[model samples]
Target: MLNKYPLWKNILILVVLAIGFVYALPNVFPDDYAVQITGARSGTEISQQTVDRASEALEEAGIAIKGIDREERSALIRVTSSDDQLEARPIVQQALGEEFLVALNMAESTPEWLQAAGAGPMKLGLDLRGGVHFLLEVDMETAVEQRLEATSSQIKRELREERIRYLGGDLSDGNNIELSFRSEGDRSEAFDIIRDRYDEFLLDESTEGENYLLNLSLSEQEIQQIQDYAIEQNLTTIRNRVNELGVAEPLVQRQGADRIIVELPGVQDTAQAKRVLGATANLEFRLAARQDAPRASTESYPFRDEPERTARLEREVIVTGENVSNANQGFDENGMPQVNITMDGVGGDLMTRATRNAVGRGMAVLFIEFRTEMEQEVVDGQVITREERVEETSIISLATIQSTLGSSFRITGLDSIHEASELALLLRAGALAAPMYFVQERTIGPSLGQQNIDAGFMSVVVGFILVLVFMAVFYRAFGLVANVALTLNLMLLLACMSIISATLTLPGIAGIVLTVGMAVDANVLIFERIREELREGVSPQLAINAGYSRAFVSIVDANITTFLVAIILFAMGSGPVKGFAVTLSIGILTSLFTALVVSRAMVNAIYGGRKVESLSIGGKLANV
Candidate 1:
């Protein structure tokens, strides 16, 4: 009775193993290489016409598509191979146009029953799924300058509200704003206003002959905060874009002081990925310039639809894309495409104040875009190619203030439905705080990913077999029980990962291999302990119980330490290392359960409660 487990205990073990097997079953069903097509904006449905167009495009290209399935909002076109998947996406995109987003993805092929129970396959990392990895360098200087410009605009507004007239204020030396006033009183008042209201800025006043100068520069702490905010905002914006792309297990994290890393696993179309990730389009609402407005206070931009024509708008912004809470694309009463915009509470108040006094005045929506271009410059006699950020502004819409606008309003004048949809998508996802350029990009094809999968699988299989052989030969019957528990350990590990949707990379597979060895070591320790107990002239049942009872502490201690290390790695490491750490952490837990509990149960069933002299642990040590 010493080594015997209670009925409920055995039942609980069986139930756990059953659940593990159920959850881990989905991984056996591989995903289908497919192209997913969805509306660029919400409320657009997948119609039969769209499906026909996609099918026709694939057929004309001679790319064999397995089938087409249309859901309520999207359609999936399963292809025969990865080549077809890659080639079919562009063809479909060209056929469907910009109104629809055609993305290369892996379609789930799990059985309906398993899917119904919420069982999903473990997500593969970019290295295993063949996607795009991008290293983007953010323009931190541009971010700071943008902040300064906003601060300058706020200061100008504040001075005007206080009836303090300043000649002009300009962002000087890219670090601070310098204001020139005609009188010392105006400069002194402005300095006090800025210093009192904006604690982040360092205000200094100087007398330049007759002109009074007031300079406002951000404090070091404030600058650092701005930089941190820019990076955090960019990461969030990039994540939103990646989600819109419908990527699975995408990685978007800060790389360093001024860089970001994005890994889009299961996304084969790098062009689409790059376009979405690097897009820096934002919207600005400004009142149209009056006929007598000063040139210095107004800026001109060409129309997005009619570039030959230009419109001038006030330099002050009423609200920006950051205020947009939601946007949806729809058709106006005139049957032309339009975007319905919703603003946050703060934005709504600002819009109401800006529109209340200028009911009939026209307001222009400015679309600002930042693009990165390569320029060659001779630096130290070497021609170095550098990326230059170019800013382009265009007026997308100009309409009279229809009564008084509020949190919810509609913008018309979009050229096409596709343009309207794209604009709505951009606005809905929010805007990037600053422009980012891709400094490095790596594309992994599905074939290469398959190769990695094959290699990883082979390594696991080989390592597993070797561990099994060593365990079986060294300890005979107890080793066989360990092997059975080892198999269950793997199942439980996979189940845990799948349940949590963990991304498995090549290094993660390495962790699994390491887990196998550690599991075997645990069993080896217990078997050796049993051998020692038998040498001390203990009975088989007592030796078995003592071996397990004594080994539990060591197993728990060792696994706990390893689990701690894995937690630290996951916390401090990036994509690959994190993937490895996640698996190792999970494996440590599953291995502990199997090595101590499952193997003990099996050993108890094999040798417990009966009159036995020795365990079938090989060598003279077992001959007690």
Candidate 2:
């Protein structure tokens, strides 16, 4: 039976298929592609009057305060303003700082098409997202000193618990302890009494004249072990904090034995990141000075108001940050910003005991120290005081004792909306470990990104038009069919890209250009075969069928090899290179299907089972 179909009918079917694919495009994009409005910082130190004044100033400058969240030590104000103006940043900073410390958190606005397009969620890189990166160098000397102090404390605690009474130098000072013996016989008895007790920690010992000298030096292997443990501990602390940031993919790894590298891709404020990362997390709970202590004792306390004194009273920490299990930003009873914190089981027990004992006494103060630069002139001609600013430590809080130090508590001293917000975020994110500091920073303007997009579009348009012209001019009517197939091929490619939500880079445009050239090659092969068959006196229908069937194998083989190469490139590539590979692979697949299936279907329908006398292969047969 001879089956026939109209040429227009086949063309209509092809057009419908292309439109259907394009319509399905939005389904492939992600649903939750918009940027989220993450919460802000707060504090108690800031007066309400100052906040109102700052708000008025911002309004006067045309900046809108979108939202406000308060914390113990600061306030977080979500503001709508231009992020890139050099003049705007300083104006905002000065206006806010006049009454409170402010930290700005800025992120790119969400694209409007994100929801409509249903594209996958956008993942921002470190460069575009602005966050903190740190390379921490561990202080081995400090670690060694800490170990020595711990060893001494342990020895004293054990002796006191055992009720041992032997006169010797103090272990706390790392000096020789000479036992006071009643006689030579008592000396031998005292030596035997402590020998077995100190066996585990004792190093090599020898008699030095009238006393036995016991060495306590740690071995090289022990020191190395201590260093390794410190590095691991630091890494663990950093990982915990980064995880708390709610970031999608953060890079945290050990660079070497004593260093670590941390990368936070979408962090908006580098200063806050630095604060979190630079915190030592070394928490301590210390008893406040007794009111009955002598005036002489008070004078010796490091913090003194004396003009001649350089040292000040060092506010001792009662509980350290290590015991904290969770931290969150929240409002206190009066709507002030405060960081709510919970401690682990052991820490809870210790805190409970400490608070119970100190409940009626002076409140335990939380002291937070951070390094900053300050300029000072020589007070006297003889003294060499500051020209270039140097690092100085400043206290962050002086909260009144309202409740006992316990398992749960809040820290509040927020001066402005922004300061409070950042601290809350940092605490929730986890206090970052020390040694991580920024080495480089950069920011890209959106204008530049837009310009790149425009240039890329023009290049692709020019290249595609040139390919379309060459194909149509060289192959006449047959070339027109090829061009239609080529157009469909590009449409399908775009549909697939939209479906996958792949980011298109400049190199990806080049891949698309290459695909256009390759798509025409398949049609040229089939057309030349048809011309050859026609010259030999075969009917147009038979020549077309023979041409398609013979050319199919070669076209499939060539495309399959190229497809494999693209896949390999994608697997091994990163960033833009992977983008190029993805577009190129999509192009190869779409071109093959359109050039073979689509073009052949159209030609078959046009000729049907009837024989034609003349068939145009576009221009000259050689042009094919």
* Candidate closest to the true structure, highest lDDT: 1
Angstrom error of the Cα, residue 336, model 1: value is: 16
113-136, model 1: which lDDT tens digit per residue?
999999989989888988888898
Note the Cα lDDT for every prediction shown: 0.86, 0.57
Output the lDDT of residue 80, model 1. 87
| lDDT per residue as tens, model 2, 1-624 | 132446676777678565636444443442211111121222236555555655666678776666554444444555543342322345545665533334434432324464454533334334433345667666665566455544544444344455553334233333233333234454444445456655434444445466544445555767677678777777887777666556534667788677777766555454545555555434333444565664442222222112243222223334455567777777778887766778788668766765675665543223233333435566656655442312223333334556667678766665544455545554444432232333334433333343555576687788878877877887777788888888878777776775665545567777878888889888888898888887777776677877888999998999999999999999987655676798899899889888888887766666657656666675333211
Q: What is the lDDT of residue 309 in candidate 1?
A: 100
Candidate 1 structure lDDT: 0.86
lDDT of 2: 0.57
